[model samples]
Target: MTIPHFISIGHITHDLVGNGITPGGPALYSTCAARNLGISVGMITSFSRPLLQPGLLQGIDIRCQESQKTTTFANLYNEHGERRQIIESVADRITSTLIPPEWRAVSIVNICPVANEYLPEIVRLFDKALIGICPQGWMRRWDSKGQVFRKKWENFKEVLPYADIVFFSEEDVSDPKKAVETYLPYTKMVIVTQGKLGASIYSHNGVHRSPAFPTIEVDPTGAGDVFATAFLIRYFETHDVPESARFANCVASFVVEKEGIYGIPGLDDVKRRLNVAR
Candidate 1:
C-alpha cells in the first residue's frame, strides 16, 4: 500500500449547522484541503459508521475506530463574529495504536484534537514526520451544560516540544501573545489566525504579519483549519515562512467564499487567486 504523504489524527465531528448535522472536524477539513492541494491524505479518526458514508472522502485513505456516537458540536456565532460552542457529545479517543506502522513515518502529520480526544503520547509516535498541531481542542473546556470555554493546555510542555509547528486562532485563548510565547520556546513555529485581520507568524526572528485576502465570508467555520493545512503543506515544500503565509492566506480566502469543504481550493484555483491578488 502506498503511504499517505499527509496524515491527520482526531475525531470526525457532527456539526449542528442550521437544521442539519454536517460532517466536520479539524482532521476532516485538513485532509480535504490536503487532498485538494494534490497530496495523498490519510485520516485516523473515530466516528459512527453512518455518519461518514462512501465517497465522502473520495481518494483519501481512512482508518476509523467505531464509536457509539460521533462527537457533536453546536456552533453559535455572535454579532461580534465570536463563536460560542457547545459540545453535545464526544466519540472515542484516538490512540497511537490505531496508526499503521508504515504511516508513522509519513512526511507530514497533524495532531488535530477536538474535544481533547488525542493523547499527548501520540505526538511521539511520528518520529520521522513533521508534526503540526492544531491546539484548539486542547485549549477548550466545557461547562456542565456543555458550553465550551477557553482553558490553558494542561500538557503544553509535554506536547509542544514534539510539535514542529502549532496553529491556533487569536480567539482560541484570551491571551494570544502569551500562548505564542508559551509555544515558541518549544516549537519551531507558531501561527495565530486573527480571522479577517489575517494571521501572525512567530518564529526565532520575530513576529511577522500576513493580511487576509478581502472576500465576502459566507461561513467562517473551517477557514482556520484550511489555513493551517495550506501553511503546513507550503512550508513542507518551500520552507519559507512569509511565502507560506501568503499562500495559505490566499488558499483560505476561498474557504470562506462557500460553506463547509466546498470552498477548499485545488492548486490551479489557488494559483488563479494568487495571480488576481497580485
Candidate 2:
C-alpha cells in the first residue's frame, strides 16, 4: 500500500498523562487529528504487545515497531499545571531498520516521543517533508522517586536543523526572551504552546501568536501534541501560519475540554470551532 499521507515516527505509549493514565503520544494524538482532517497518517512506534493499549494501532495505515511493551507512566498534577510524572516503564529505542519501508512516502513526520525514541539517523532517512517535533516526552527527567523535573537537552541541535517545525510548551519557552536567540536560527518555526493562554510562533520570516479558543480545561496532557499536529498539517495545506495556528488551537482547546486521548475531535468538529472563531 502507498504510505499514509502523514507518518508520525515516534512512541506508542501508555501515558499517565496528568491526573490519570491513558494511551497517548504523537502516534495516538497527532495521527488521529491528522486522519480526522482527511489526512492519511501512519506510525512507527515501540510497544510491548501486552502493555500496548488494545486497538492502539488500528485505523493507522503504516506502523512499525521494535518492542511490544511501550512506555508507561503515572502522571500526577495540580490544577495550576505543575506535574509529577513517574515512569513505570520505558519503550525500546526506535531505529531506521525498525521503520516500515513505506514510510518513505508519508507527507509529514513528527518525532513524537514519550522518551528519546527517535534516533537522529532514522530521521535522516525520510525525504524532505514537514518534519515536525513535539519533544516534551524526550525532554523529561525524573528524580529517584520518578518525580519529573526539567533538565538541559542534548542532541536537539543535531536533529533540529533537520526539522521544518518544532514544538514547545508554555514551560518549554518560559524564557521567550531567549527563544529567538536560542531557536529561531535553527529551524523553520518554533511553536510555544501555552495551553488556554495560546501559542506563540517564531519563524525565520517573523514572529506570530494565536490565542486558544476558550474552553473548560480538563486534561492538558497531549494538548500540545494535538496542537502541533493540527497546526503543522493545516500549515501544510494552506501555508498560512496564523490561520493554521487558529485551526490547531481550536482542536487543542477541544482536547483539553475533554478527558483523554480518546477525545481528539474530528474535522467537522474542528471546522465548527474554527468557524465560531472566525
Candidate 3:
C-alpha cells in the first residue's frame, strides 16, 4: 500500500514543564504519532531552529515558518499531573502561506495548536483534506498572576464550521444544554473526552461512546492530543467512528501510563494494548 502524506499544522515549543517539564506542542506530538503509525507526515509550523530541532529530527518533513525563536512555555504541575501556567512563549500566528506549495499533495491535515497558531482562517485551507483539530490550544488563555486560565471565546462560536474532526475535554463540553446545539452546525463530528470517564462522539448521525482503556495514568498533559492524532491516522484506515473513538481511547490510556509527551505510545504498543483490550 502506498503511504499518504499528511501535514500537521501549528508550532513546536521548547516546553519548560516543572517536575514535569517535557517537550510537547501538539504539532510535535501529533506529527510524531502519525509517523510512528506509518503515515508520511510533514509539518507546517513556525519554529525557531535555535529552540526547535528540524522536523526531520523526528521523521516529520519541515515547512517551518522560520521565526527567530520557537515558542517556549513552562508548564507547572502539582503531583497530580494537571498542567497550569505558561511561563513564556513567543507570540506568532500562522498564515496560509506558511503551508509549503508542495504540501498540497497531503491527504490529512491535523491542526494542532500552540498558543494562538491554529486560527479559523488557516483551518479553512484544509477544507478538502481530513482535518483533525485539538482546539485547546486555540481556547482563550491568559496568564493571570503567573498562572494560565483558559476559557471559550465569546466569538469562538464562529470557528466551528472549518474542522472535520474536533477534540475537546469534558470541561470544554461546558453547558451541554447549549453546546450540543451551538456546536453541531459547524462540526461534522465532535469528540468530548472525559479523562478516565472515556470519550463520547457526537455527529449529525447521532452519538457514539467508547470507554477508556484502564491504565495507571502518569501524565495527562498530552493525552488528548495524542488520542486525536492516533485516532485520525489509524482510524481513517476504517472510518468507523466507534472504532476511531476506541482506538483513540487506547492511545489516551497509553499516554497517561508514562510521563510527558515522550510517553506517546509506539504503533506496536498501541496495537498490543488494542488487542489486549479486545
TM-score of each: 0.97, 0.91, 0.87
Highest lDDT: which candidate?
A: 1
* Tens-digit per-residue lDDT, 79-186, candidate 3: 654556663656367788867655654678887776776556776565567777777676647665435567764444556676678777766545653665666787
Pairs of residues at least 3 apart in sequence or in different chains that clash in candidate 3: 17-21, 18-21
lDDT winner between candidates 1 and 3: 1
Candidate 2: worst-modelled 10 consecutive residues by lDDT: 49-58
Best candidate according to TM-score = 1
Q: Poorest 10 consecutive residues of model 1 by lDDT?
A: 47-56
lDDT of 1 by residue, 123-229 (tens): 99888888899988898999889999999988988998888999999989889998888789998889999999999999998989999999998879889998998
lDDT tens digits, residues 1-278, model 2? 67777878777677765355567766678877787777877777777753435664567774556575677777677868766677767778877876677676567888777777766666677666788877676667767776667654566787788788888886753475575567667788888887768988888787798988898777787888889889888898899999999888988888887766777888898878878767
lDDT for model 3 comes to 0.72
TM-score of 3: 0.87
